[model samples]
Target chain A: GPKVLQIPSHQIIDMGQMVTLNCDPVSNHLYFYWYKQILGQQMEFLVNFYNGKVMEKSKLFKDQFSVERPDGSYFTLKIQPTALEDSAVYFCASSWGGASAETLYFGSGTRLTVL
Target chain B: QQQVRQSPQSLTVWEGETAILNCSYENSAFDYFPWYQQFPGEGPALLIAIRSVSDKKEDGRFTIFFNKREKKLSLHITDSQPGDSATYFCAASGQGTGSKLSFGKGAKLTVSP
Candidate 1:
């Protein structure tokens, strides 16, 4: 039962400020991902990072959103000059490698409220 | 394109009753079909999953029936309990090795006593 932990479970930021949401994934996981879910909408794929580089991303991953695992500690998602539409539940997930099998372990998620 | 679609925005069932959730998808290469359960303020946890090679996979009260030809699936919970209430999402992913989850809109299930 591996667990993914997220810091600052909730955050409120101004419309033009920067916010960094953090995640600590399972120790043995090699794959990492970020997913966003707007209120009352399905969870949408954002971006994925592994081996210190982005492997793939979806259309929803915007320029304002950037992910980094500085010092290989915390996987942080930073939003610069946040907009009203930036508000959503951002989730972090990690999984072990598989030829066609990536079983993800997700965090509780950070609820971002951009006002 | 939206690869996955689930039915019933919400559902309510009494204790000891059976709950069935349906889902459909557009991707033919998607080999893994999984169902995730989410409580009020928690993350979605993997409940049950099935591969295209299998028609059914059962674990405890949760069962996943997958039809690869139709690209459809269903989750059946037998003798449901109140603790089983949660938002259930049907997800599908292709033969990739990363976050290729094409998720459905999700279905909310509430089991009352």
Candidate 2:
């Protein structure tokens, strides 16, 4: 079965430091997304990427957050000067094209802890 | 605005009973609805999904009842087992390319023996 893979299962970083979360989407997938789930909170959409460009983004995707797929590279979420509120489980997912078009494959997730 | 909303933050059902989770969305453009199940320490996995064209979809012991007019949907798990206990989230996606799913707050279900 096709699978999405994320790196660094868990990370603990200090406030004001930078962190990069990486995701390797399914080989043939054309759309990638990032979601954040804080403890005891709903999973929030952050951003979506397609064709090596950001297609759409949500308010939660702050100025500090950035996503990129460099040369068919892994989709990545980078946060500069991480805040305490940034602590959450970050999930990376990929879909064939559209949600109604195909199912999405999600990675195990990268748990970020800001201390 | 929260596109999707779920009722009863949590639910408790006896083993062998049926568990129903409710969800509603305000966006008419949302044509895709999917239910996801999550256990502790793991990302949510797709349990089932339904398109707007269908009113009912079933697989195994899980079923989805969708009301297009009312903009509501429900997930029913039959013969609920203790192992079926987990957090379930109903999500809706807007029109177009991976447009970022809007998820409900989630329902924590517990099936007791």
Using Cα atoms, each model's DockQ against the true complex is: 0.56, 0.66
Model 2: fraction of native contacts: 0.60
- Weakest lDDT window of 10 consecutive positions for candidate 2 chain B: B93-102
TM-score (C-alpha, index-matched) for candidate 2? 0.96
Worst 10 residues of 1 chain A by lDDT: A96-105
Give per-residue lDDT, candidate 2, residue A30.
Answer: 94
lDDT of each: 0.87, 0.91
Each prediction's Cα RMSD? 1.4, 1.4
Looking at model 1 chain B, report the run of 10 residues with the lowest lDDT sum: B94-103
- Count clashes in each candidate, considering only residues at least 3 apart in sequence or on different chains: 0, 0
Winning candidate number (lDDT) = 2
Write candidate 1's Cα lDDT for A54-105 as tens digits: 8888888889889999777999899998999989999998888631476777
Candidate 2 chain A weakest lDDT stretch, 10 residues: A97-106
Residues B5-95, model 1: lDDT tens digits: 9988899999999999999998677888889898877888899889899999999999999888888899999999999989999988867
